[model samples]
Target: MKNKQEIPAVIVADAKVFDYLKEKVGERKTRTEAYSDLLDKSLAGFISPFLRKQDYDLQPCQCHVTISDLATEWHWHRATVRSFLETLEAFGQLKRTRLAKSIVITMPVQSGQSSATFVIQRQPDFAIQLQEVLSDWIVGKTTSADVGNLCGQVVHQAMTGMTGYESRHCPDSHIDTASAHAGKQEEEIRKTALGCIAHAALQRVLWKSRFDDSSPLIEFFRHDLDEEWVSFIEASKELAELILDTEACETTFDTDDDKERLKSLRKPFLSLLARTQEPAD
Candidate 1:
């Protein structure tokens, strides 16, 4: 869990997709373009207050955007926009603060997201420390300049090292084998318990808020991610929500520097998370 985490920001306002959105006005919009447009709208000109509270302490790239506003902008249904924002938060791409009925997102750019947080030192596993970013790079959830960039670097590092690769299968002693296998099994069990705890915590929060039913979390993952990755991503999203709660929900900036310092501090792990199967990045 301690690794060099990355938040992809390859999305931009300039793309053929941008032209497509304009050409097909009032038509469907891709997650990429919708995110770009949202950032653009938040930075410039006054975005009319559509929330219950007209007064917002918003900064350059921070604003309170209603699902309705996003739907109209992207020509999509309100439900679609709301679902996308929730997905973005799951991927840790959006800095969000959930309100009574609205959400505030602080989408910062450049050095605004830097942080100086303490990182837990990891125990050695003879694993190569080759990492710059780790993500599935889904089109809308996130993007990358080249999805294969990290893989190439990993190969390069291994080939350049004393050994092309290091996978020695020395037989483990009985005690060692038992410990390792038991630990692996326990880890899985703990993750399951954690995922349930996270899901229930979210549901309880919504229930207290008078939400009739808050089951979007269950529904979204059923379609967005592979079945195996559901618990992983959900747990990660809950962790992100907790981190967001420690920061300013939304605020007015006295200066650009002041705003930059207030940007989301996404401190990744000290080591890359181990992938046992498909996410073999």
Candidate 2:
């Protein structure tokens, strides 16, 4: 058995591959268990010749295949095959290079031509969490609200415009416009506000559950807050900490106190309401 400190060849080959797996399967398993389970499933092609035959066809001359060709030949969904190919690339098992022309199809001809082909080099021992999340969203088990929350989090990291006091880049145009139109006929803005409040509350509860106590909101504040919301950004961290600490108190509040607390929270968010309520300026 290898020591836990020892680096596995699989991980060394592609660190991104392991990150992909951890993001999908989660951080619960022991290192050995993660290695064995991911490696065993990913390397099944080498262990089972029949399974390999079922999934891929070996050709003496052919070095590259289109994603669609592999999907049709193996009787697998195109998206599934593409996902596996991505995993292989991530793990350093495969190097995918985009090809311009259509390759010969061993299976029955599909109506459409494939846009690109990939060179299958080495199969990776990891998978993609984004694809998994998308699959879950498609299956109806995950709600639109969950999808929105996850997208918001990812966008928060990758892009600056979507989060914090300077949320001009957040993708709220369509929703905001629809909300405005709905406001004329009914209380759409109120409903939207309620939903945002509920989501914020849920996030607070989840944070408390994980930390056993409230986390300092300053820890999650966006670094770009200062750049965009210049005036408010200076004090945003202090304000956020105050809000979080106030919200974290154990005792339930009466209606008056609840209203007052909400009024306080709304004050900060309202400073940017003009920007958020209007179309991206």
Candidate 3:
């Protein structure tokens, strides 16, 4: 038997087969394990080293073609192509449709093979179109601003469009009024904006919290700002009191504590602005 390293090296050199293997087995595993699994499944044996003429016998000429035609054109096995088609459909890129057969194939003698025709439909590439539309929107509105402002604009556009759709097509008459749509849209926008602001605020705090001799709470804040900020502030307060207890001199404002306090205060400032802003403007 060939050495384990030699087998995987041979398989990995073929770009097409290597990519397929990598997709099946993630990047974290050893190459030997991936090759062993492929060999065990008989996939390695079935893979053709060179294209065969029969592979293109029933290929389609159009850009929009059936799964069977794609399989033939790409020289992929029928079952593998079927699996790929199913995955694409799940991702909303393809649609499948059925057609009634106008003619049937009859075998001369008792044969095991049976044949049927299926019609395949391809969805309009909405995912790519949506990405392009969003890119254009952002490009037109691009400006130098803080992260919070950028995130706010993106969220506003997405929520407004989604709310417009909800208003037009909502089936429940009781919940379909203009006021209800506006209220729900505002609530959603507020939640999303607040979440973004919180993230930005926490990021600023984390960046400042890092020093030559940082506390564990400060380190934790850097790693997990959302969950650790409250605890960090509480611990900072406790530390402030400890300093106060030890010092007998007159109270003098500490710059570090003042900065930490200001960092904690930015969230409420953004929240107030968000609450006061009108949706129409």
- The residue-by-residue lDDT of candidate 3 on 1-281, one tens digit each, is 94544210100123244445554333333333323332322322232223222232211211123435444544555555555444333323334332231111111111121110100111122222222223323333423253334455455554455556555655566454645655665664455345434433433343343332333444445654556767657644544454335353224336766546534544443343233221211
- Tens digits of per-residue lDDT, candidate 1, 29-113, equal 7665676676565555234466635666776567677677777867777766766676444433456777666667865432232
Give the C-alpha miss distance for residue 275 in model 1, angstroms.
26
Model 1 residue 117 CA deviation (Å) reads 11
Model 1 lDDT-worst window of ten: 117-126
lDDT winner among the candidates?
1
The number of the candidate with the highest TM-score is: 1
Which RMSD values do the candidates have, in order?
20.8, 23.6, 23.5
Superposed Cα deviation of residue 112, candidate 2 (Å)? 34
All candidates: TM-score: 0.36, 0.21, 0.28
- The 10 consecutive residues of candidate 2 with the worst lDDT sum are 115-124
Q: Of 2 and 3, which scores higher on TM-score?
A: 3
Decreasing TM-score order of the candidates: 1, 3, 2
Error of 2 at 250 (Å): 63
Q: Which pairs clash inside model 1?
A: 2-271, 3-269, 3-270, 3-271, 57-251
Candidate 1, lDDT over the whole model: 0.42
